[model samples]
Target: MKPGSLLARHVAPVPTSRRWLVPMAWFILLLMLSAGMGQLEWLFRLVEPDVREVIYRRAGFFALLGQHVMVVGVASLLAVLLGVGGAIAVTRPAGRDFLPLVSQLASIGQTFPPVAVLALAVPALGFGTLPIVVALLLYGLLPIVRNTLAGIDGIDPDVHEAARGMGMTAGEVLRQVELPLAAPVIIAGIRTSVTVNIATAALGATVGASNLGDPIIAGIVNGNTAYIVQGALLIGLLAITVDSVFERLQPASQA
Candidate 1:
């Protein structure tokens, strides 16, 4: 078959065992990271001997992980909506004039450092997860917006013309033709946005949002290497697992 049928291959059913493996592995890893960090309690006691063995007693590791996912999840959802929505709007004839402005705003949002955002936001929103969510949402927007715009714009004009020639309305063409062709690209953007935020969400620890970074921060404050290692390990694992899922979902064309 020609390369045109590649997308069909992309949607081919994954092995039943393989489909379950990723989620099961993800959950097992997640459980280990979130709750398993406590298993190091004995190790901490052995090393410290005198100091507070469990400096990370503020919350269980699993609790912090849940908070971490929550913050990143909310932020990524908002970014996807705003990013994809803005991209679609600007691509349309009615909003074409604002394309430059939309692109520029997303650019600025990404370039703006999370720390600076935290500093500025804390005064208005006060501490907690809200500011971090806002920061991550803004930071994560560029990829989705840029990818959406690129995906939609890269569509062959002939395909759109063919759709229109078939007596399809603009809305119908977009719904049935434009979006399917653009989906892979748009999803690529979403993958990037979500993956990046998973790491970035750790910044919430600095602002008292309390995620995986808690251990790292506490470790740093107390000069305890064990805590830092625990936090960093779990966060890294989470990133890798999530990125792997995205990798699987990525279209063959993206390859």
Candidate 2:
């Protein structure tokens, strides 16, 4: 009935359901595009008027998409486990001395570049998904480890003391207090790690991993602009979809 109520009604915050809907829409669009890429031949033909074959038919889009997701998923999972575990361990009394070493190693891992890691790993692992996964895992560790360390170390000393004074065991304190408070920062790190890996996973095609990057690589080799567009478009859509999913999860992490 008042001016404030009218203003509040006009400027309402978006509903939580609506926030999740965006990512769902993107995911559905990605699936639809992947399944129906052949249907868009005319569109690609416009882009590459000279090419006899505009559609990428060496492998199905869905299959390549799955491979891309799998590669990123496996690598990200391993990075999270190792990064968070190492960060937690280093923060403990017995492992404090190793903190600097672990941090330095993580920094080095990120700085060394995934392509270089792939070059080194492929020789020993001999190509395929293993080397790609290993490279991605190594490349993705720094963000998760750095964020986990920051989150855990940034906790107030008084809070830890209070948690201990409340008769909470060390394990319980970590599980209940430290981790809960740190979840948002940790999730942010994971989000960054995952999105970056999605782009990096494209490199796997060179090593015979067979992913969304296939089109781009093939296009480059054959000088087909259409194929490159297809690969780049799908990769962009996939990255946006995944990043939106993380956006939806961010609030949950904060809570």
Candidate 3:
């Protein structure tokens, strides 16, 4: 009966001091990795080498970093579109008949190994970014689809009934109520998908995709621990940065 109850129910709760924390932390993390990498040289050399080695200066850090981002970013975007869209579709009344089919198809990516996907795709797509992109895209779909299905389907039946009783159209209920309520869960799915793909995308370098994995693969091939440490450290930092950003991005209730 309160004037603001309806709005309050739908609006995401955010803490004032912490509302800007996630973005600021992400920016600072990126800035430190970008600008302060040189000052951290000793950390990259802590691993014992089989032979004397120089720092990994073979490729520009930022360029490889950029390419890595592009590979995972494109793949994640595609997965979100396909995964979320598919989940949304199956949850709808008209599309309920195909829910089983949609779910099974989404799971194939998880069951199939990324390496296998790349190996198979390379012949069709050639060796470059495309195969790996396809691999990452498939590998990342399971979480997104699973989480989306849970979020939307888990909504309280009363909420839908209330919306319908109020004469809200199906589209309006979905837009105004269902998605906002489910967004945090959906975002969590995306976070899982993207974070996993960041590590998985490194495999792209094995297929000549030129990501952070290049140093890692090269290190393995040459027995240079420094190169391995360098690549592994950067990839680890990148994962932490991405995870932190998503942590802050979660809905307040979810957070």
Task: Output the number of the lDDT-best candidate.
Answer: 2
**CA displacement after TM-score superposition, residue 50 of candidate 3 (Å):** 5.6
How many clashing pairs per prediction, in order?
0, 0, 0
**Model 1 segments more than 4 A misplaced:** 1-12, 42-55, 252-255
Against the true structure, whose TM-score is highest? Answer: 2
Q: How are the candidates ranked when ordered by lDDT, highest leading?
A: 2, 3, 1
lDDT of 2 by residue, 1-255 (tens): 421121111223558888889999999999999999999998999999998999999999999999999999999999999999999999999999999999999889889877898899998999799989998998999999999999999988988887777677899778878887788899999999999999999999989999999999999999999999999999999999999999888776654
What residue pairs clash in candidate 3, if any at all?
none
Score residue 251 of candidate 2 by CA lDDT: 76
lDDT of 2: 0.90
lDDT by residue (128-214, candidate 3, tens digit) is 999999999999999999998999999989888887777778888888778877888999999999999999998999889998898
Instruction: Give the winner by lDDT: 1 or 2.
Output: 2
Off by over 4 Å in 2: 1-16
- In candidate 3 the C-alpha lDDT for residue 59 amounts to 84
